[model samples]
Target: MRVTVIGAGAVGGALAALLDRAGHEVSVTARGDHAVALTESGLTLDGGFGAHRAGVAVVARVPADTRLVIVATKANDTAAALAGVDVPSGCPVMVLQNGLGGDELVRSVLPGSPVGVGLALFAASLVGPGRVTVTAAAPLVIGGDARSVAVALPVLRAALPERVDVSADIRGAQWTKLVINQVNALPAITGLSVQQTVADDRLRRVLGAAMAETVAVGAALGVSWQAIGPVDAAALRPLQAPGAEGVAAGEELARMLARGMGDVPNPASMLQSIRRGRVTEVDQINGAVAAAGRAAGVATPVSDAIIALVHEVERTAAFVTPADAATRVSTTQD
Candidate 1:
């Protein structure tokens, strides 16, 4: 299979390397020094999924005969990322991003192509230009329009490690991932690894409130929750209670997810974006929760607070202390 991957950041870089290692013809589009590094030295993969170097075709433009196109850019970059890539009609484009509605965004971009939206359940970071490290290895989930998913699923299963799952309801899977993304906010705020943030009592409590609120939003909207990693509708049942027990359960789940990522100091993708001085996707991840809550007439004060804090960091380019962020999150609940 000839695969063309745009946005050679962490997810894109890891996918390109893995697919190339699986003996597929892989070409990646990247700009700036990252592209230069990939061109000069190839891609380096290490950590959770083992180490390998995949020498793939690196280019600034998509090839005409590309069999598959994978866009792993940040959610906000979805439109711009597809700007110049003239995708072949009917070619499957699997968009891997966080938050909700990724497939719809792509559908609007490449209407003629079969489009499936996806997310890497495992955590892979672009540690450096041309380098990707998988701190946590878990299944990658893909689903959307039937034709698009059919085109992308088998090829992904063959090339990827851990696993590749096809969700009949990608929105449900995304909602589950969205609940888990409660972890991404504090890590971005405190400049801490996910483990470090989960270990803080105040910060953990704040996130717990946010998670419960998110579940409320999902339930109000009647979203069917799918399991992504350790999260599923059943696992989130405790959060429906609206009390300490629910918050505790949410915290425990967050801890389990952090433990799954290992002790490699995963700063998480949002924090990585903050460090790079780029915009974080807190809008799509956390802000999306608040927006849905407003429309559904549910209260999401906690995650809404987190969104404000994330924006503060983006504006000032400085992370907050766990205590300070906790204070704000708790106050919002009050």
Candidate 2:
């Protein structure tokens, strides 16, 4: 299969390497120094799966004979990344991004193409130009039109790891990922790895509050939540209701997150963005939840405070302590 990855960031680069290793013809579109580096040195992937260097075709323009197009650009860059690229009619385009609305955005771009939505649960980060580190590996869920899934499955299976699955309810899966992503801003604001952030009891309560608010908003919007990996969205409903039982359920949810994470010091994408001096995706992740909550008349004070703190840190280029985040979370009124 001939694949074209639209972004050479973490997920894009990692998938490109995996595909190339799987013996597919892979080309990646990148910009600035990253493009130059990929062209000169190829792609280097390191960490848990060992090291691999693949000489993938690095191009600024989308290649013509590409069998599949993978949109791996950041949520905010999705529009600009695909603006000029011409995708063939009826070709399958898979959007591998965080947060929501990525599939619809891709559909808007290539109306003739089948847009498949993917929720990538793994952790990969761009540690250097033309290099990415895979900290964790998890299943990639592809869902949408049946024809599109048929087109994307073989190519993705060939290029990606063995944990890829197709779903009929992709939107529900996406909402599930979004609810999980609400915890991402906490790590970014506090400058801690995801595991460490979730391990702290105070921070875990904050995460619970944010997640509970997200689940509420999602419910109000008529969105059904599906379980992503081991985190059961149905089990989390108890956290949304007010009571001592709900508090206990929230604590259990936090513990579940901690256990799922183990001791891996993997940083969330938003934290990685701050470390790279790039604008974090708090707006699309936690901020999206808060926005939906407002429209649905559900309060999202926890998520709102986290968004504010993350943006402030982004502006000042300073690290926020976990203690500071706890203080803000405590004072935030639901």
Candidate 3:
């Protein structure tokens, strides 16, 4: 399979390397030092998937001979990333990204091609320009139109490690992934790794509150809910329990996510963006939930607060203490 991955950052780069390791032809689009590094030394992946290096074609444009396309860019960058790119005919496009609206955006941009969405249950970090470290490992769950799945599933399943599962209800899978992503904000706000944030008593509760709010929004939208790794719908329903039980369930859900990442110091994607002075997808992540909550007449003070804090960090390039983050969220909840 000739797979061209646009936006060769953490997620894209890792998948490219793995596909190359699987003995498939892989090309990735990258820019600046990252592109130079990939061209010079190949793309390097370590940690969870084990150390692997693949000499993939580093290109600015998608190759005409590309058999499959995967747009692994951030949610905010999805539009610009796909802009002006001509995909090969009959090649299905998979928008493997965080948060929401990525597939629709891609479909709108490339109306000729089939577009699907993927939720990476694994966590990876772009430790450097051309290097990606897998902090956690899980399947890449894919879903969308039936035709796109038929064309892309076998190729992807054969190329990637572990399981490359497909979801019948992609929206529910996306919501499940969004619920998992509630761990992202607190880490970005406090400049802490996910495990550290989960271990903090105050911050843990704050994370629980944010996650609970997200689940409420999903329920309001009538999400059927699919499992993302160990996170099943049943595991999350307790998050809707009243008062203290809900809080504990939410915290437990956070812990379940943390345990999946193992002992590696996973810095979650949002913090990675902040540390690099780049814009984050908080608007699409937490902000998306908040907006939906308002539309559903469900209050999302905690998610709203987290979104504000993430934006503040983006502006100041500074991280707040856990105490400060927790207090701000608590005050809003009050």
What are the models' TM-scores?
0.97, 0.94, 0.97
Better of 1 and 2 by TM-score: 1
lDDT of 3 by residue, 1-334 (tens): 7889998899898889888988889999888899999999999999788889889998777889897899999999987877766677667898898888889998888887888888988889999978999888788999997777877788878767779888999999999999999888888898999999999999999988878888888998999989888888999999988777888899998988888778989899999999989999899899889889999999989888999999999999989999999998899989
Per-residue lDDT of 167-286 in model 1, one digit per residue for the tens? 888889899999988888888889999899899999888878888888989999999999887788889988888688888888888888878888888888899899888898898899
How much lDDT does candidate 2 score?
Answer: 0.81
lDDT of 2 by residue, 51-149 (tens): 889898877667778888889998878898987777767778889988877778889889898888878877888888888998887778888877778
**How do the candidates rank by TM-score, highest first?**
3, 1, 2
Model 3 residue 281 CA deviation in Å: 1.1
After superposing candidate 3 on the true structure, give the runs of residues whose Cα lies further than 4 Å from its correct spot.
none
- What's the residue-level lDDT of 113 in candidate 1? 88
Compared with the true structure, all predictions reach lDDT values of 0.86, 0.81, 0.88
> Superposing all C-alpha atoms, what RMSD in Å does each candidate have to the true structure?
1.2, 1.8, 1.1
